[model samples]
Target: MATLLFVLHVLGAVVWVGGMAFALLVLRPAAHEALEPPQRLALMDGVFRRFFRILWHVVPIVVLTGWAMWLGWYWGFGASIWHVHLMHLTGLVMAAIFGLVALGPGRAMRAALAAGDRPGAATALDRIRKGVSVNLALGLLTVAVAAWGRFGG
Candidate 1:
């Protein structure tokens, strides 16, 4: 059971973090270079819609499996190692950022697009871009801490 939970947890993390990396590094730049504002915004709208939909499922799984490992398979929360605590903290931060993107800018973008307000959509997309960038950095830091902190402590 623990092994299965670990696998699910890792998969969830990979999907969420890897998707953010691809959006920030590859898709965003490519769209900016190749597409006009309207097209770019449309593309981003579609991309984020799909990605966030998947995230709705992935985030809960990641959280549940992580807690299962920390509180069930190994030590309870209070007894967890520093790395575990760091990972949990960063993960929650990422989730909070995601929540803001999904609820605030994300909905605004959709509404702006539907109403044919390109500039408003752009502003919302900018907000999402910044949020995703921060989350990506935190995700990478969490991964590093999870890997190296195990040995450091």
Candidate 2:
């Protein structure tokens, strides 16, 4: 049970963090270079739609499985190490950020695209990029904490 939970937790993190990394690092650059605003924006909108849909499922799995391991296997918050607490805090923050991006800019982009408001869509995409940048940095930090925390004590 513990192994299963851990596996699920890690997979969730990988999918979320890795997806962000790919979008910000790889896809954004290539798309910007190859496409005009309308095409680029449309491509991003489609990409985000698919990715965010996957995230809806991944976020819960990550959070729930992490909590399950922390509470059920590691004997809960009080018994866990400092890093465990940090990881939980960071995870929740990431989740909240994800929700904000999805609800706020995600919707804005879609609506703007539908209305043929390219500038509005571009603005929304910029906001989403900034949000993802922050989350990606935090996610990397959390991963560092998790991987190295085991050796700290």
Candidate 3:
């Protein structure tokens, strides 16, 4: 059970982080270079729709498995190591950012697109891009902390 949970947790993290990396590094650049605003916005809307859909599933697995491991098997918050606390803190922050993106800019983007408001959609997408960049940096930092913390102690 623990092994399965661990696998699921790791997979969830990989999918979420990897998807962000691909979007920020690859897709966003290609879209900007190859497409005009209307096409780019549409492409981004579709891309985020698919990616965020995957995230809805991944978030629960990651959060549940993480809490299970932390509170069920490993030491709870008070007894856990610094690394675990840091990971949890960062993870929660990432989740909150995701929520903001989904609920705030994401919704706005969709509504704007539906209303045929390209400028509005573009603004929303810009906000999402900034937010995702921050999340990606945090995610990478969390991974580094996880790896280094294991060996440090």
Candidate 4:
């Protein structure tokens, strides 16, 4: 169960984290080269639609597996201070990003798309791009600290 839980946790994280990295790095470059204004806007709409749909599934898995790990730890040793801190901080940041996407940029993007405003969509995309870039950096930092936290203690 522990191994399975660990695998699920890591895999879920990789999908979410890796996807963001790819979007920030590889996909953005390719999209820039291969697409023009209308195409770029439409392509981005499709990209967000698909990626965020997957994120809806991935987020729950991450929460479930993460909680499961914490529960396992709780049963084993009562509580661990470092894990708690890491979990809390990472969870807060993740929730913030999710909120931004769900309530902020997500709404803006959909509104722009629905209104068929390319400039509006572009503006919304700029906001999302910046937000996701921040999120990606934070997520990577979280992963690194989580992996190496024992050393800090």
Best by TM-score: 2
- Best-first order by lDDT: 2, 1, 3, 4
Clashes of each: 0, 0, 0, 0
Clashing pairs in 3: none
State which candidate, 3 or 4, has the greater lDDT. Answer: 3
Ranking by TM-score: 2, 1, 3, 4
| CA RMSD per model (angstroms) | 0.9, 0.7, 0.9, 2.3
Report lDDT (Cα) of residue 145, candidate 2: 96
Q: Per-residue lDDT tens digits of candidate 4, residues 19-125?
A: 88998899888999998988888888788778888888887888788788777854532565675567657856885786677568767887888998878989888
Give one digit per residue, the lDDT tens place, for model 3 in 1-153: 889888998899999999999999999999989998889999999999889988988988898899998996577888998888898999999999998998899999999999999999999999999999999999999888888987975
List, residue by residue over 59-148, the lDDT tens digit for candidate 1: 999988999999986589888878999999999999999989999999999999999999999999999999999999999999899889
Candidate 2 lDDT tens digits, 24-66:
9999999999999899999999999999999999999999999
lDDT of 1 at 53: 96
| Candidate 1: regions farther than 4 A off | none
| Per-residue lDDT value at 106 in model 1 | 94
Ten contiguous residues with the weakest lDDT in model 4: 73-82
Best of the candidates, lDDT: 2
